[model samples]
Target: MCDMGQWKQSQHFFEHLLNDSNNNNEDLAKVECSLGEVLQWTGEWSEARKYYNRAYDRMMNIKPTRIKDLAYILFNIGEILYLEGKYEEARDYYERALAMQKETYSS
Candidate 1:
């Protein structure tokens, strides 16, 4: 849905998935992150941030943290803050993401 530029449909689909109880934490976290991306596409910064933060927390709690995935999420979080005129906060997240990405990709 998102790849096709169907923002609303993508958001609805992700919301439905989020509401489903069958998904594991890892799956749920990805869905939430995707929903946040959809929201970001629609320019809903605050709502997008909420979902991103939730997804970030869930992903962090999982063992063997997925560094690449975390980097993407952190970058998105930074983007949201940047869009909201929070440059300092955005820089913090962006820096974190950059460090993570560098660490992840350097090896």
Candidate 2:
């Protein structure tokens, strides 16, 4: 549903999942992050930021072991920051995401 360019449906699905009262469901967090990416693509930065922040908060607490997922999210954040014209902050995020990708591949 999310990867098919169906941004509105993806957003709705993720919003439902996030508010489902299931705090331990990591899948919800992942979807929320993806939804944020879709929102970003649609130029809805403020809404995107909310979902991204939610996902970030959840991911921080969970500390996902998948470096690829982490790196992707970081890259998305960097991209969003870049789009928002926060060059320095975006660079920092991009650097971090790139470092993570490098580390993952090197290992």
Candidate 3:
């Protein structure tokens, strides 16, 4: 759905999935991330960041946390900031993501 550029449809599908699931943190996080991407592509940077933040918060509560997932979200956020002309902030996020990625893969 998202790959085809149907953002609204993708958002609706993700929202439905989120609503239908119960205590499914993984699904929740995925939906939030997908929705955030849609919002970002639509130029709703603030709203997108809100969803990204929610996804990150949810990820924090999951067991055996995946650093790559967190870093991916951070990278997306960095891209959004870069697009919005917040170069310094974007650099911060990019560096954080790069550090996490290196930490995860270095071992």
lDDT scores of the candidates, listed in order: 0.94, 0.79, 0.90
Residue-level lDDT of model 1, residues 1-107, one tens digit each, is 78899999899899999999999989999999999999999999899999999999999988988898899999999999999899999999999999999999899
TM-score of each: 0.95, 0.82, 0.93
Clashing pairs in 3: none
Ranking, TM-score, top scorer first: 1, 3, 2
* Ranking of all predicted structures according to lDDT, beginning with the best and ending with the worst: 1, 3, 2
Error of 1 at 28 (Å): 0.5
Write model 2 residue lDDT over 1-107, tens digit each, in one string.
Answer: 65688878877877777777765746766877878888998899887877777776677667556667777788888888899999999999889889989999998
Q: Distance from true position, residue 63, model 1, in Å?
A: 1.3
The deviation in Å at residue 103 for candidate 2 is 1.7
Residue ranges of candidate 1 with Cα displaced over 4 Å: none
The prediction achieving the highest TM-score against the true structure is 1
User: Which has the better lDDT: candidate 1, or candidate 2?
Assistant: 1
Candidate 2 segments exceeding 4 Å error: 2-4, 22-25
